[model samples]
Target: MNLIQGYDPDTLRELVDERECAERLAEIESQRSLPVLLERVWLLKVLDRLDEALELAEETVRQARMAGTRKDLLRARVLHATVLQNRGAHAAAAQELAHCANEAEGRGWFGIAAFAHQHHGRNAYEAHDFDVARESFKRSLFLRREAGADDTELEKALRAIDAAERRSAEAPGVLV
Candidate 1:
């Protein structure tokens, strides 16, 4: 299976075309490679099949640990954490993503680090911790710039920060 065509996480999230995801999932159903597993995890998550997503995410992590490279393992873990976040295990997701972001940054994988920080910010945003979300989003923006990400990515980070700031300002008992 060609893993490059339809598995971009950013595109998946931005478009959120359920039929497209379902078709892709069907196409990849028999593939058990790490990349395919990762794609499956994301597809399931986006399709709102959270239980299946979490299960496949856990399996993907295990497979990455056994056979994939460190970068692959980190990518698997990030997806696993995102599934956790989507499943409402906010604290667990935050902890996992914090480790991921730190590890990615330490290894100078700025693109991966930015992705982790961006999702970490999303987790905090969903939990209504707007301050943390804004801080994380800002960090993601910095990391994205460090990675020389494209304008689309940078704009997404900027938008996330703005959203967090707006939420913080509108929240009750928030000072600003």
Candidate 2:
């Protein structure tokens, strides 16, 4: 199996240096592979290339919907949600992520389920719906914990929940 198969895209992202990642991802995209396209979109999202990511994610969603596989569909949906979140469309992002979470949970894709919840948490946080943010972050924390996500991510999620709760409880009218 190739390195791409041996390692999850998220982990591989961490391993690759930021400066060179785009080049590597571009090589993968040259193959015109669906999964690779989704991965590239994800990488673009992470790199803050929001518009480009959105374009790829939209295409990924269309293609994955045609495939009719729950896993592929969920992946594309999650990426689309993430790109939407990057673009500040929090409500729609949450809707997309919630759909992905429902499907991934049903299919027992624990990691995808966790990521979906995490994306929802991020959307809620960005929207300043702190109560919902806290709930979503807590839900994501639980799911990510069950998925065996690294302690760093679990701790970060917990911290995010705490922070959101703190932000929510702060005296209103103060610039948070």
Q: Pick the TM-score winner.
A: 1
Give the alpha-carbon lDDT of every model.
0.87, 0.76
Q: Write the per-residue lDDT of candidate 1 for residues 120-172, one digit (tens) a residue.
A: 99889889899999999999999999999999789889888888888889899
Q: How close to the true structure is residue 108 of candidate 2, measured as C-alpha lDDT?
A: 79
Query: What TM-score does each of the candidates earn?
Result: 0.90, 0.78
Q: Tell me how far the alpha carbon of residue 97 in candidate 1 is from the true structure, in angstroms, after superposition.
A: 0.2
TM-score of 1: 0.90
* lDDT per residue (tens digit) for residues 103-176 in model 2: 88888788888878877876787787778878887888888888899987787677778777777887386576
Deviation in angstroms for 145 in model 1?
Answer: 0.4
